[model samples]
Target: MNSSAFRPRLLAAAVSLCFAAPAIHAEEADVAQAGQALASISVTGARFDAEPSLAPVGAIIISADEIRRAGANDVNAAIRKVGGVYGRQSLDGSPDFGLDLRGFGTNSSQNLVIVLDGVRLSENELSNAVLSTIPIDTVERIEITRGGASVLYGGGATGGVINIVTRRPQANSRSASMFVEGGQFNAGEVRLSGAQAWDNFAADATLGTQRTDNYRDNNEFKQTHFSGGAQWFASQFDRVGFRYEGARQEMQFAGALKEAQFTAYPRQTLTPNDYGSLDSDRLTVFGQRRLYGHDIAADLSYRKKTVESTYFYDGVPSPATYDSKQWQFSPRVRKLGAIKGMVNELVAGVDLTKWERTTASGFSAADAEQKSKALYLRDELRFDPAHEGRISAGVRREIFDKDYADPLTFAAYDAKQALNAWELQASYMPVANVTVFGKLGQSFRVATSEEDSYTPLFNKPLAAQQSHDAELGLSYASATQKITARLFRHNLTNEIFFDPTANFGWGANTNLDPSRRQGFELDAEHRINAAWAVNAHYQHVQAKFRDGVNDGKEMVLVPKNTLSARVAWTGASQTADVGVQWTDKQRYGADFANDCAGQMPSYTTLDARYARTFGQWEWAVSGQNLADKNYFSQAFGCKAGIYPSNGRQLKLSARYSF
Candidate 1:
């Protein structure tokens, strides 16, 4: 018991389960068994809404049965149960997994924006979104849209967006499944999945492989993944679908540890022959139609990625390679009528992109090209329908063209940018279950092309990174309980970061003048009967730097309180789950220096799962962290440290279906 005294009794039992969630109130057939004990619904910031707590902001849905009841092995462990989402993986999880929303620190993949199944899986030269290239067994849900979606997914969304839906085909379902696991240090995994249908057509597939031999010491890892999909209906409302995914990975980078080598060898390895490698491919196609009253959709995608790395500064190695190709197109239309007396719904969209990249080694060789386009519109208004009110507005116009070349000697770097964004939302329910919302937004990001041709050599004057976002929300749902609360704020201006005093840590990509991030969030769910249930989330953020010389410091790994809780039980067919998380203590070097010295402490973790079934066979056991916690999820140098977060993980699994 010491984690500073068991972390205030686990943050006072997660604030007493958020005030006992309105003192549980079941009925309506116990609310579908309490919404299956936490998860589902919430279609990410509305649009043909699926009720994300009556959208207007704040959303988090992670189904696929909550990723198999949180045995989650990707999407950063199922997006850390929402709260204020945070994730950073290393020390064995291999080069990937880094996310932070609503307070983008360390450039969280250039401020969110990750979608799949609707294409657009980021990466304009490291605007990452490689959650192991989809394979939480082909996720079937994963909304998560908290704020500022850049007027419908465009340009690094400025802290929001994470679609990722997968799994299709229904008609007359057919199934197949397989999973296997092994744990403790020399980990292991295997997965195979299937689905099928006939007549109107359908299909699905998944395959996976994972390996680990990590606990430091040249952190080992290897991975492989693949996904497939197909669908067609062609009638009724017409539809079509297609998907494919692939991945290959390799790792070995053990490079951070200092603080007396993390109290003497926290799995040692401060650059054990640094390494990295990745390969990827993706394809997507989508279609939908329903003319007349409108409801059209279209999507197309293609992607390719390749990366190689070798680093070791003082020890000299420095290898580099990155190859990329991408193409995306999106089309949208939706409509609902009656405007004179209120009642309206309209959505419009157009986004297209083309990208190419190359960054060779043996000294230098570069080529980059990018093109983007965007046009967006949204409208939603309803005045009355029994205690109701709604209004939404959106606008977007984006344009970019960036190029960087140097095929031997024709050195160049060109850029052009155009941006416009807007969003305004309002909602009210007055009763009939409660809802209240507000939002105002704007987002932008630019200055890529490898940060303008190989990150400065004497060049400076790169701009584009703007944000202004706001949110206010409230929600309550009856029939067993659900709650949401929010208050968010963001104000960024020319805030591009990565400057460890110019270039010591591969930094240099600087800009920071105004910065601010305000926050308060809470999410709750309850059902204390029908086999127990509970859920909780909390966040309190304040990230800063609102002027000159580190105006108010803070904001470097942004974390000022975050908590999560979960509990579930079923019985008849057997199930059990438990969860806990807390993070608070962060600061690890940011521009405008905050007296440096680096810090990152504050951690708590626990996860559990149990499953049982027989008819079609299923069995499970899971554990992660579970009090074997001694954390430090991230930190970098200038003497900061390096990766070390992963301890106490156990696994056992079996599954079968036909």
Candidate 2:
């Protein structure tokens, strides 16, 4: 896995590919034709391959080339390129990667909707889809709609949405690549992918594996996966595709950090038996097809997941081990320009899943299962001749098991709730240089299974959460820099947040009313020279629960301000990039005064990276946390906490093209 070995292998592959076919060079004018081939890739919400000068809300795109430069080993690290994104391995030494869309909260369990190639990874447990359930190796690109997309995507889209787009075979080339990565935190990984194209047939496959020693003692995680797809262009008017993805992930929990661990000045560590571990396996199969017209297409996906988790506290079993399984699927169809002045596209889908738990101590023999389903359709209106204006609206219905109650209190009361959502968006372009836009949408989030059937010691059932998103932005394109600015806000109701200290109970889902999160973002990308580019982004957030159970309390785990800047140099022989990020920290808990803990301190960090390519080989050398700063990303239950982050670590990696 050394750079030298990678270099030779890559050279050999390039030689083979070149000699395998008759060498022919195209003309200079053909460069555009060659580049256009890459543009054939299209996504659900992408207006076109052209990057929008102004985002509908706030967003960032990290191309595969960008990931390679940063030496990203997996999608978890590759996703950090976005301005507001942050990732961490939670206390259990497990993969708890999360995104703070529109500044809802830190962890995935808090809020946010995640999707993979149009399939709902957590379709069944919408509100509880943790990061470990996903296999990052297959992600080609991630499309993030930064604000709540509940209008079209109902449920759990409280903070917004993440659409994971996997790579596919192109009609023009067959390429293979393999790489290995190693770093601090006892991390190691290997990934390989191959794709081929011949006439009307194409295929692709990806294989990967990873392991990490507990950054905390005894809390380790290991994962393996395999995925592949094949497609046939039955004719110029029709096409169909089939794919399969399977994986398993395991982690030994290290429990929440103790106050002593964080207070330790120089170094902190975990003790044995902080918690036990669990392992899980998941498999999925999907099929899709497209009609001749550039206007119609459809796809369907199904997945099954089985998991086992254990718990240990005080060096003894805590009776928390459990196992479960589920089956889920989503089918969708889309049509473009179905009308003249009134353009329309409709997407209707349903979700079905069942779960059963093994009877265990401290937990309950509460063997129960649940099912949920939904169907939605949205139509878009675009008035092109009368200037530029577009409108979109949609709605959906949901049903969940209500009888799955706690066995101790066999007060079986199962009922299903149905909700409706809608959205409206408008964009105007008076001239070429400017485009003004505005949006308003209503979305609701369903409760997790745990939340649905629970008594917080002495409290009652927690209510479902809901919110609305409103936004406005302007885009100005210039010869050098492309400037885009946006101002948005989210109003929430029945927000469910963990309350460590509450009346009549150890913990309860406090209903916060009339709360809101507001923020502003400005992004600019400028080409300084033919070989140099500069990008800068600024974000500011002000969030708090305005009323109800948690009133007047500064929001927990929310960063008030952030600033990021990067300058990249591209040359025929090498590329270099350097970036810096500054963050203003806030608090770690909802009501700190009630829990005797104060607000968190703020910190800043800097990073630098460089990469070079020669022939069929590539190499990268980078330094993260260059300043070696120590700070916290998240915490829990007062003084005990583990910052889902590492300290001033260095990374080096190489890739071979074979």
Candidate 3:
């Protein structure tokens, strides 16, 4: 059967079930109680998460309470324990790290979609959306979708999507918090945040600064961030919000070492004079209104970012600068409630974004511009009472245009591409405590400027990548325990990737023939009692080249196995947690021939945290790599060996809240 007919048939079956709902009677009170328990631990960043058993797309949520309990210093630290997430650490011990998802390798800047408060943060092409710009002290919660989301989020969501939600003021309330921390490696941090609200207005702000003299030679870093937001309730049915953020940071780079050097002196830096800096600013305004019995929302945002870097390769001076600016607008409408005696929820939206970047190297200058527009519609239906079962379908059409030009050289290049994406999802609860779900979707990802035109002499735009995704999952939840298991696969064509083996020392963009990634994930949380709990997550994935010269060969840098486990205990005044993480060895790059000579070794780590709360004051202490195990967190080609992860380090912090 054609896939196009699958969606219509699914919709018809759901409607028929709804019309025959009277024949089936469920325990209403029991259903409501089960729903309450599900809601307490459900993922809600997506439109389907509003109801029970409707989110079948492998979603994970990390709350602020969890973050604080983990003694997380940044976003990367808080998300490391999540399944299917691999955070590669640097030698400096900075939390501004890179991540790999769904066996997508180590370069996630072009494969992941990151957002903050409904505003696109990594929509530009200059650099990764530095998560450091958003202070963790101000975050309320984070939502992560582990699979492709091109139908919900516009583009470059081939790997997944991460949405960060910030704290908002409570009605008729005011609060403040302050934190100070100091640790090994001469690290120091300070943060302050406050929120206030009146009858119909609320405002909040956060300020933070941190500096560290890293463990490696010539690796020192400093950063400062400011974020604020205000919201006004014009009436009971309308509200508006404005948010602003700015950040500045500077750091010295310690280039990678050779194999022998890394083994003999792990903390040595190959390039001690290299340095980099960043400055960024963003502003967003959004509004929501209840009109015509529907919910309407709109947002507008502007962002400007600049980065400069100087590196010495083989004792040769090389300096470069990048400046990028972007504007985005999104408007959406949602309809909820009964329609034709069936519970129906519908959503429609449009998104528009424009971005421009300029790069200067020595005396040569180049400019690139990109624009995207999309229209999308989604519908959800619930057949049984209390939304025991749900079916959701969505479709999106997107248009993109990109251009690059050099004024002095009179060189120009342009490309235009259009893509269509759709997904079908269904979830059913055979029993009050168990849910079974399935999803099928098509996803698209366009190439970025860096991936297409930023090479030494490349000016042609790469072909857009496409993926066919399918997933099946089972979830079980009780009042005190939860368990989830998922099986997923992604078939990709013309997958764009960085070719480090091309053009000598400079990397080039290339499209691979075809590839496939299939994986299984298991996650569980159990509360032994009121004072003891345990959580564990595991993922096993196999990534291989399906066609071309590398057919049947495993993809480099994509690990086959990963695991995370944690145990915690809480008392009246104190809480303690112990966690362990492990990763399996995989092929390392440098040679595209899939040679076993470049394989990276596997390693595991142990960590612990303890916190005490008394009255309005709190104290916490944390230790990472508690076993002092030596491991390689990241490794490049054969020429650039591996970077050693941090050794045993301890830190203490103090916080006050009122």
Best candidate, TM-score: 3
lDDT of 2 by residue, 68-122 (tens): 5555555555555544354433444545455566566533444667666655554
TM-score of each predicted structure versus truth = 0.33, 0.84, 0.90
lDDT of 1 by residue, 1-658 (tens): 2222222222222111111000123344443433342234345343443333334444666678766766677766677653337777643345355677765765676788877766766657544466765777667777777778788887778778878776656677788888888888888888888888887888888888888876677878888888887878865346787888888878776655656776676787766786676778778888877675466778888888777776656788877777778888888876645444444556887888988877677655877788989888877766675766887888889888877767665567676788988989887888888878888889888766655543546433367888899888888878898888888898988777655555554446667779888888888888888888788888788889889777888777777887888887888887888888888877764324666555677888888989898998888888888898767756644334446777787888888877
Worst 10 residues of 1 by lDDT: 14-23
After superposing all C-alphas onto the true structure, candidate 3 shows an RMSD in angstroms of 9.6
Best by lDDT: 3
lDDT of each: 0.70, 0.58, 0.73
Rate residue 347 of model 2 by lDDT.
47
Judging by lDDT, tell me the better candidate of 1 and 3.
3
Give the per-residue lDDT of model 3 (tens digit) for 256-350.
66567877887787668877777788899988887754668888999887777776656887777777888999888776555334455678889
Cα error, residue 408 of model 1, in Å, equals 66
Ranking by TM-score: 3, 2, 1
Model 2 off-target regions past 4 Å? 1-41, 46-59, 106-110, 123-138, 234-238, 258-260, 265-267, 275-300, 338-362, 385-387, 405-413, 457-460, 478-480, 503-505, 590-597, 642-644
